[model samples]
Every structure is written in structure tokens, then in C-alpha cells.
Target: MNVKNVYIAYTNCITPLGFDVDSNVQAIANGVSGIRLQENSTLMTAPFYAGVIDSDKLNTAFAALSDAKATRLEKMMVLALDPIIKKSGVELNAKTALILSTTKGNITVLNENAVPVPDAYLHQLAQNIVDFFGFTTQPIVVSNACVSGIMAVSVAKRLVQAGLYDNVFVISGDEVSEFVLSGFNSFQAMSDVPCKPYSANRKGVTLGEAAAAALVTINNSEAKAKIAGDGSINDANHISGPSRTGEGLVRSIESAFNEAGVTAQNIDYISAHGTATPFNDEMEAVAFNRLGLNEVPVNSLKGYYGHTLGASGLLETVIGLESMARNKVFASMGYDEPGVSQPINVLAANLDTPVNCFLKTASGFGGCNTAVVFQKVNNGR
Candidate 1:
């Protein structure tokens, strides 16, 4: 048996800020936020802050690809993956695979007055994209709550390492809809203003919508970053809350560190899952402190993109890769002061620094937590 090293060949994303990776990077660098006060009776009764993509812009871009009837979420998924697949120039054969990550795939269809559509099924949503791209392998769906995106990366790495596939294309997306809005509102987690992750004045999460795609392959010709290691663990503590001791997140990071052969000191930066929720932020702070990463520069993109849910992990991962490549760390928007009981270095201002290795983490409902370590490729090593 032999092991293969996986590298991120290419990446792209569709967000309210921009369509491609470069645009999104510029937006973040400029401190631009996609989350805004959205007023739409169709999605929610009262005005709330969220990161909703422009429907017209999405349709206009998607129209160029295909006129075939597809749901809004489907359109986003396809749009996010199209450029990456074309750029990679990989053959769509049995040895190549497609993985879709989303917690609510086509879940908006249930809000319609008409009969339910088959696309509401996760597999069906995936099938639509698979058929559109003509992928020969059965599409794999990783929908483990909010960890779905980064977990998809872990899945791809394992598949390629095991020789199950030579190339794996991963795309993740979720749209802001009435269902999600109402669900968060019901939990009293919908913030009145744009979310401020890890801030004393933080209220709650501001929902967001986005689609991000990445190419995981044994090829390193155009590698953006090497996927060194990853881990996903469930604490089984609660249904919707995280562990009080941050045990799950701590273990998840430790697993990633052990596999990557790097400790907390080696992590130059951290893209944390700061959802702006009290429990989540505190849990992450405790976890980092437990892992002796308190002084590490950490930031959460939730302030700019809000909580993008299933799309968040990979979206942040893509942004983190860009940060490493550009040698700059974007500010953790909305973080004014320390809000958590534990001490952690939450970046309030953008820093121009060299980032060699970084960690991306996500925690979600059902006590799920995932962590992945990525390092910049040097001299094609």
C-alpha cells in the first residue's frame, strides 16, 4: 500500500462580494462586508442582516453556462465549480470524482406553494450538478452540519490517498432562505446588525449565502497549498451547543497537528469558526488556549461574510490560502475587544506578515467539529 500527497490545484467562489477568487480576496483586503440589512417579505417578515447574493447577477452569469432550468442553489453550485473544473483541465472520467457539501441543498423548494420537487433531496441536488458536468463517478455528498465544507476536503484527501480517485473536485454552497432565517430566528440567533465575531458587543449570527469550489489532486503543478492533515470529531455533548470544555475542538486540532507533524507554535495564523454566538466563540477560545495557541494571530471571516453555514469552512479555507500566498492576514471584522473568558489573540487589524502554515476550523450542531492544517508549497515540495 502506498500513500499519496494531496494539493489544492485551484479554487474559486461565488459570493455577494465577487464572483472569482481574486475579487473576493480584494474585497476582504479592503474590509468590505457582504452582510447587510436585507428586507424581503419572501424570505422573512422583518428586516434582518444577512449576506444574500444578487439573484439577477447570479442568473446572468449562469445563463451563459446553461439555459436549462435549475434551482437557485443548483445554479450557485454549478457557477462556483465551473471555472475550477475548466481551469484544472481534468478529464471527467471514473478516476475523477465530484463531491458536494451543503447542509441545506435545495431546501428552499419546500417554501414554495406548489408541490415539492425532487431537487429538495440532497442526492438529487448533487445529481443535477453531476449530470450538468458529466461526471462519471457517483457524486459524494458531505453534509455534516456546518463542518460539511472542510469535511469534504478531508474526504477528498482520503479518497485520493486510498487510490479511489486521481482527482476530486469539491464544491459547497447554501443560500439564505426563509427556512434558514426562520430557523435561526426561532433560536434567537439572528443578529439585528452585521455579525461581529468574537466581540463583547456581538449579538448573534447574521446568516450568509455563498458557494466555493476547490480542486484536490495528487498534482502539484499549480498547487495553491498542500493539504497536510485534517480531523473531524463529535463531542456528543449537545444537540445544538458546543462542549463547555472545548474538548471536541481541542481534540480535532490535536489530531490535525499530529498528522501534519506540526504543533500549535508552527501555526502562523488561524481561521477560526467564530459564529458570533456566545457559546461558539467561547468554546473556540477555550480550545485554542488549551492547545497553547493563545498568542497565535486568529481571525474570523464571519464579520465579512456572516455565517455562511455549510459553505463557510471551505470558503474560509480558500480565503486563508489566499492570505498565505499574499503574505497578509485579513482582520477579524467586528472584533473590537475580547469577549471570551479565555485569552486568545483575535486580530482586530489586518497584518502584513509571512504565513507559512495555518489552521482552519469549524464547529457545528450535534457537537461536530473539524480542523484542517494547510501549508504553503515551497519549490514544488
Candidate 2:
């Protein structure tokens, strides 16, 4: 692939922290948290907090479609995508490529039946989007667990670079359901309270439901950031666990750097996939220290976003670019004491820094991991 320029035209996200890109960036800048305790409920019966979007507001905004037979996951995807689609002025048609990413796509339907596998549930969700937009092109679904969003972006880049499509619509979403909650409960990975990433007293993860989308193109003159290079690699060590020494993550990072032709010191900020889990955080620390970037500002939006699963990688990368435009970086909230023995400088407060280039890393199940390097285009636009 001899692609030179890739642009993120616009990003729209619905998270517990903020509703849109501007508000989300503000929350990140102020070091605000979106996690709140969830009361007893049939779908989610845990004491941990979550970053949930305002359902009432969403319902009001989408009231016109109330008569339609749209699932909650589908509604959430449209809600996150409405703003960007409206601004892009790009009609949803065969000319547009739709790449949907999710870990558990509309699994709530399966929970209602309990007679089908996860894959069946996913195909149905893809059909919903294709029908919603009345598109003739086949919808491509990527389900590489937590790295799904970044993987979706990588695919979109390739398709555009290949001239398969001029505009790519990347939508990622996952909703809270009983099945996933029970699975995490079985793993004993649900936090009792709001998650505290990189903190010594951190408990576990608090799953969050969210959807976000970005319009990608080869010639987006209004992009907030440019996609310089992206790389993905599998560790093949464990399907559900990460490498202890962060070897896989290191490999992905090296590939991203080589693709971007940028060195370690060129990276000004890192949006880590700090899921607050014991193994994940420890592995991230090792990766950062090994890269000799222990001094650079490092933080995880998981503290605020509460780990949006499939939507997280794109959501965090969007925030990284927005923060660069704003000239400030968010601190890893709920982080006071270092949890790992590694000398990783977990940011304690928001800092004003010149961010020219940033890196986003994600590690997920199936030994899948990805690293994407983004640079701010200084074309004086």
C-alpha cells in the first residue's frame, strides 16, 4: 500500500462522560469522571459504576424513529453516528463503505432466546445497519474483541487506499446485557466501584456501553488529525490473557513507529488501554518502560470512559486527537498510587503540553493487539 494521507473527517461519540466530541474533550481536559454506581437491575446487578449515556435524552432526540423496529444497540449506533453523518453531508449509499465493529453485537437478542451462538447475534446486527441505511454494499463486521474499533479503522484505511471505496463509515458499539455481565462475573473481573486504573487499590473493570463513529477518507481537508500509520499483531500466547512481558504490545508499537517513520521520542502522549485489570495494567507498564518512555505523559481514558469495549479504541483515539488540538492532556483520574512495580509515571494531574503526535494502543482477547500512530497536520488550515 502506497497511501500517503488518511484523514479522520469527523468523530461522534456518546459516552457517560460527554455526549459529543467537544463535550468529551472538555471532560477529559478537566479530569472529570463519568462513572456512577448502578443500582440493582435485571440486566446488570453489580455494585460497580459505569459510564452510561443518557437514555432519556437519546430517546427524545430519536423520537421520530420510535415506531421503527430498531434494537437498542442499533439505536445507539445511529445516535452516535447522527452528528457525523449530518456534518459530513455524505449520503448513506452504495458509494459509502460501512464497517461495523463490536465484541458482542446485539447479544441482548440472544440473551432473550438463549438458543443461538454469539456469531448468529452478530450477523443480525450487521443486517440491521445495512437495512437502516438501505445500502446495497455488504456490511463488513469486525469482532476482534476489544481491539475491534481500531481494527475497523485499519480496514477502512486499507479499503480507501485500495480504491475499493471513497468514503468509509466506521461504527462501533456494544450495549450492556446479562450474558456479558455474567461472563465477567464468572471471571470475577467486575469492579465493586468505579474503576481506578493504575492505582494500587484498583479492584477490577466496570463494563460500559457506548457507540461511536468516524468518517474516513483519502482527501478530508477538514480533519482534526491525520492517520499516519497503523499496525496490528497477535501474540499467540493466550487467547484470553496478555503476554506477561508485553512482547506482543511492543511488537505492535514497533511496527506502528516504523510505519509512521517516527521514533519513540517523537510520541508526545499515549492513550493506553489501561483496563484497570491486574494483568492488563502490569503489561502496559512493562511496555511503556521498555520503550524508554517512562517520562512521557501516560494516562488511560478507561478511568473516565469505563472501558467501552469495542467502542473504546476509537473513542480514546478521538479524544487523543481532540486533546492535541486543545493543547492539554488528561490525567489518569482515580490514580494516586502506582500499582505496578515498574517505574511507569502514571499521570496524577492534567498537564499542558504540545502534542504533535500521539499513539493509541489496545490489547484484547484472542491474543489480538493493535497500535495506531496519529499526527497533527500542520498545513495551516
lDDT by residue (tens digit), candidate 1, 1-381? 455788887899999999998999999999999988888998898888999999999999999999989998888889999999998899999899999999999987876646667778899999999999999999999999999999999999889888899899999999998888999999998789898889998899999999999999988888888899899988779989999999889899999999899998899999999999999999999999999999999999999998889999999999999999998999999999889998999998999989999999999998999999998998453
On a 0 to 100 scale, what is the lDDT of residue 226 in model 2? 77
lDDT of 2 by residue, 73-140 (tens): 78888777777877888776666888899998877665456676543467678877777766578889
Model 1 ranges off by over 4 Å: 113-116
Compared with the true structure, all predictions reach lDDT values of 0.92, 0.81
- Candidate 2 wrongly placed segments (more than 4 Å): 64-67, 91-95, 114-120
Candidate 2 achieves a global lDDT of: 0.81
Q: List the candidates' TM-scores in order.
A: 0.98, 0.94
- How many pairs of residues in model 2 come into backbone collision? 0
Model 1 CA lDDT for position 319: 97
